[model samples]
Target: MVSSFRHHRRGFFSTLLLLLAVAGCATFVSNISVDVIRHPSNPSSSLPAFHEAPAFRNGDECSSSSATGRVDIVMTLDANYLRGTMAAILSILQHTSCPKSVTFHFLAARPEPEVLANICTAFPYLDF
Candidate 1:
């Protein structure tokens, strides 16, 4: 009976390990799928890039120092990275400070640059 009990324990652990291995594989595959946004045929294709520009009030210089508010800088990325990156950015933003009104700009690249630029520019402070 003791030997049979030991065998049962070993089998249970083996099954548990198998399930863990499968779970680990699924996680790895999910991450790989997220990192692959562009086609493998053309890695040279450039996605629209975003930049932060200083916001200015009317009659204020483009590089004005009159702007006074907390600048909430949110660097948007592909939705795939959104979950993890958002958490990280939020943590940093919680501790960081800036002197301009905070805003969020989502950047993406479809088939045209103009469309992407338009979307990015629609935000109060977005540069593409």
Candidate 2:
């Protein structure tokens, strides 16, 4: 019985490793241009506007201030995950003790002006 269990465990690990390798080898291609539409701000909108932290105002000289207690968040944005991304940003801002201390860096696959415009519209006070 122990030998049988060991064999099954080995097979399971092998399958898991195979899946990991396949997933690692998979390539994602974005052929379509992402269209970003800025949703009009509603007073009742669930997402709150996050304020910019005062520590980031020194124009890249503020790295020293970051040691005090600032957090940096980087995310890749695309049309495919817009809603979920928005939700996540909202959740982060809403739940954080110091929303202003968070800096967001968004990396988009393509140069989408509308995406940046929409992000600015959504989080006008965000320090990007």
Q: What is the C-alpha lDDT of each candidate?
A: 0.49, 0.65
lDDT of 1 by residue, 1-128 (tens): 99999999999999999999999999999988856743322345443222333353233322344355435454555534434444454444344343233355555543444434434443344322
Q: What lDDT does model 1 reach?
A: 0.49
* Candidate 2 segments whose C-alpha is farther than 4 A from its true place: 1-67
- The C-alpha RMSD of each candidate to the native structure, in angstroms, is 9.9, 12.6
Off by over 4 Å in 1: 38-128
TM-score (C-alpha, index-matched) for candidate 1: 0.31
**Residues 1-128 of candidate 2: C-alpha lDDT, one tens digit per residue:** 99999999999999999998777665322222222233334455433333322321233333455566688999988755666776777778776766667888998889876556656766777778
Q: Show the colliding residue pairs in model 2.
A: none
Candidate that scores best on TM-score = 2
**TM-score on alpha carbons, each prediction:** 0.31, 0.49
